[model samples]
Target: MAKNQVAPIKGMTLPQLELMAAVLGAHLGRHLLDELELERVVYWSDSQIVIHWLSSEKQQNKFIKNRRKEINDLTGSKHWRYVPTHSNPADLQTRGISAKEFEDNTLWFHGPPWITQPQSWPVWKECDTTVLSAIENTETENCSETAKDKRMEPTSNVMDIVQIERFNSYQKLLRVTAYVIRFVDNLRKREDRNQGKLTAGELQRAANMWIRDIQHNIYSTELECLRSRTQHHLIRQLKLYIDPGNMLRCGGRINNAPIPTDAKFPLLLPGKHKFTHLLIQDTHQRNCHAGTGTVVTLLRQRVWIPAARQIVRSVLRKCVSCKKVSGKPYLAPAPPPLPKDRMLDSEPFSVTGVDFTGELHVKSANGRDKKVYICLFTCANTRAVHLEIVPDLTEESFLRAFRRFISRKSLPKIMMSDNATTFVSAAENIRRLSQSVAVTDTLCQAGTVWKFIPKRAPWYGGYWERLTGITKDCIKKVLGCTYM
Candidate 1:
């Protein structure tokens, strides 16, 4: 937005007038003018005014709405949505990324940029304290349409005040003389209208000398007092004479000249009190020393102390109140036990196992579906074991595999595995060992216990996976194929 605009096209500058004239003049069949002639020609185009003057103050901006789609996530399924331009800080944060993740040295994106960024700089910080302060102070933010032009005015003013220019050899007297001439001219016309006209050249010369002398005397005295002073005082005097109300107002600015007072205090601290060093500095010192004690009391009544902001910050930084109560620490639940090397030291006393889906009735890597491999194991006290590559995991095939694996070896005493589907389906029947075909004495013979790891706690099955890897590698070494 445009913050301020004067009425009538004539009030605008050549560039501004040219912009309008180029765009709208084409509609009206007219030509644009130059800056040299702009001041002389007050082009009050009535038809142009009617055409460009907006009836409503604000209109819906569709460009911002179209730009909203740029928020889709680049790396993941995650995406961002349009927060109100004023509400969200997502816009501020999109500044350049650094090698360090989440480093605060870069501006944190606090919200959509309501302000312009630094000149020629594209990024803005997003942190709350920085961005909010930037917004509040009108310092870091405020991408005014004027900043590009702002760089020009101050440079020009400095040049004007300090640059070489020819003047009468009378120097300072030139200005004083000019001012006196106007003042007397004003006075004489008033006198002539009220009384009678002066006829003599001698009388006019005498009057001029008297008036000029008095003016020169007063001006010379003021100049003597001020010429040795800083240019600030000189310029300030000039502005006061030009605009007194502005010179006194807080945060007042005119033609790049800031008032001594201000329209607003940009440095005003936002907290309850100035953040200070003495209040915040970290210290080992206690409030009261090794005392023959009088009551050690905090000043119950408010006390004011003048301190630099650094001091206040230091004090607050180390304040006992801030340390004890300013924030809370987070503590999470304890972790689970680490995996063991083996469940049992000796064979069959304890055990570990692996479980996986057996092959389905689909083509295998070897181009056969006739065989399905289901594998399981137990630690052994006596060398007892079972293994199978079966047709499938149907109860009949499983039982047959068990029967075949144990045809000659000693029966297993303990078994363990991750709780998987076929095993889970058979768990109850295996526990009871009651059905004729299911209740094999070789499996149930030694009071064998079938253990399943705790639900969803695969971490306990670490050894099982390790053994599976070993077994797969062993089989690969023995057979040409990587899988059985």
Candidate 2:
């Protein structure tokens, strides 16, 4: 017979109560002994749910699975008995009562009196032993897989053809071609610097190694054998064979061609790989900003990269030196609409424009040679031009030219010229014309308005400037490059 034991249970559900009973019973059975120091354990709970869970074999939830395993491994579910809630004594500690009430409750101290009598103890009915199957936990799977064809080898048969037909210089092409060859040779030796040219054997081994590495990553499924049609279709179609050196190469086009051992078999490489990038940079730098065509031609002499032209172009596009050497031209914006003065109609010489043009060789009145600057005036509306000769750009000389222009073309309403010192600082001429009441009243009555274009804007006065060009051309025809 087991001694009476009443352990307090709190902060746990009814199912938990049963689980605790099962765990504690298992612990005592393994570690404790009864008559003749032999261990005997009997587990009891008020929860039918826990008793059913323990008895059942299936558990989907990991928490339940772990607990059930422990129970079954230590103490069998047959040892667990279901008691009515009222007969359970562990609830006294969980639901507290006054000390006087506790003292009055004998069940709280010694458990239900029937627990002492084996025949009087509660028995679990068939319905009590009935188990509920835990709904199988369902989870949605989100994994997605897509298949893509891998490019393990060059697709085109004419991989040897150079896309770019021309190169800027032969020396650049030769240097780049050598560098590419040197690069492959170094990789074959798997070392940096000073590795002499690779022989046919060494080159084949390197090419074989590269092909194996690529196939391992991309065409893993197709790597079963050389005869595997699904893998390396292009390599198979070429009737290529791996030499004793393990270098993949094609049989010669002719049965008997005088080809050197190294040149007899060409090495295979991916057209657009890290190796290609290295080759492109090497060739581009050696060629010194060679065109796409030139670089491609050089590259074709040795290895092939797919879309070689596009690759060369892309690589060169990033070359800082290339961009600097062949940059875009500076384009000025189109000529703006003509200003209000030029657009509107007026007298032919009403809105006259003026500019200095030439140093014509003229004979003086005394038959002495002299140089004179010609002030060219053009009508804004009619496009008629008048030229006046002046000995110098002085205010007096310009004033004389102005008077001559006015005398011949009539006193104009407005005059426009560039903001040159000769035109802007004409205070003496302006003062004489405005204040000289003694000389002639015609100067004051002319009411001529002088307008100057923006400073440093020679192009703004394009009307007269174009005329100057024409005048220069006509004079050049007659003078035939004369100094004058």
Candidate 3:
């Protein structure tokens, strides 16, 4: 038979905890938990607690009687309760806080279920909202826990039940509203108004989220705590991350906020708690309703939040300062169109574009040359080129070079050139003496297209432009002169 074995009753009182660290040869440190990160705390309005640890059943019973004597000796405050090891959450927290939180976030404390907590706490917990709807309508309590249930005669085994319920006047009005709407089934019509103030228990639901309590920071404390971690692979979660409501007052302006999306999770906080203007304003007003502070005081209690003119007014005014300074919303310009067809060089010189771009003083091979003009012809198909320089650009000089250029191949059906004064000039197009004055214009062939654009339209003639810029840079680098 196995004997029941409990761990030795070694209660490391605050001082003893420090001593144990030295015995184990580790440095012990003390630090207060941040307000937001604290959890599993209990508050008493008219009572106090005295703690003692007992190793055996005999000692446990003795400690109960000695508790009053100890309180009367050291601290006059006296209202005590014995909590079993299974229910003491502080056991888990003493091991983790601050730097340890990251490593231990997924950990949860096991509280031996308190029958009283589940029963009386339903006012806060089993708030499955369906009950709240019933509460709002003042209809037959949709919740199984009605006034009659609360008053049920208790057995001797029942524990002390703490009542934490607080109803709202406006909330009551909302219930009235809900009754009317549900009676007629007009939910969609008053959605905006209904969502705003009236709920079976609006703040009550929020209180469940742990945002509504601030007096002792009950819910905020729990949320700040690390009782839970997201199960996402990345421990991810989707949250607003910034409240459009408090917006810049806390984090910054709209421009600074990250856009909301479905995929985001494993959130850093404050961003997760953001609300829309209407929602946050309602929260702030709710905070104000607690009667402890002004709007600024109430807002400041949330520390990061800044004061606001009004949630609705601020959202409507559309402050550029707020948007630019913060993550604000705005429509962006659409992207430019993409090329539909893929194009490439088919052959070396089959498709050619010829253009003259110079007034250079290059020397001719003849000894007496004062300056030489380059008459260049480039093949669009092959991108191959032939160049000659002659100082003059007259028709006589042009035609002489042209004949030599045409000698290399059958006259091309399609040729491209720049829309320079010389290329498009009446003289160049007229052929000097034909009665039918032929114009030099772009023409398309089966394998190619010949075209010339007006000056400075480099983008339209990208092939030539790309090559020209390259050649121009080379010339400028070599000759110490800008491109012609």
Best by TM-score: 2
How does candidate 1 fare on TM-score?
Answer: 0.26
- The residue-by-residue lDDT of candidate 2 on 1-484, one tens digit each, is 2332455554655465556666766666766644357656677878787777787664356756777788878777888887888988766756778989988898877789899899998877756354433212210010011012232333322113322234443334344444454664567785566456545554443334444454344434433344232335654444344444333444344323464543444444455655455567778888776788998887665444457788778777877787677877688899988888887677779898888877777668887777777788899988998988789887778878887988888978778888878887664367556666764576556667789888877888888999977876787689774444
The candidate, 2 or 3, that scores higher on lDDT is 2
Q: What are the per-model numbers of colliding residue pairs?
A: 43, 3, 34
The clash number for model 3 is 34
Give the TM-scores of the predictions, in the order they appear.
0.26, 0.42, 0.31
lDDT of 2 at 475: 72
Worst 10 residues of 1 by lDDT: 241-250
Misplaced by over 4 Å in model 1 are 1-345, 348-352, 357-371, 378-387, 434-445, 470-484
True lDDT of residue 198, candidate 2: 43
- Per-residue lDDT of 116 in model 2: 84
- Give me the displacement of residue 309 in model 1, in angstroms: 27
Off by over 4 Å in 3: 1-351, 358-373, 392-397, 426-451, 454-457, 481-484
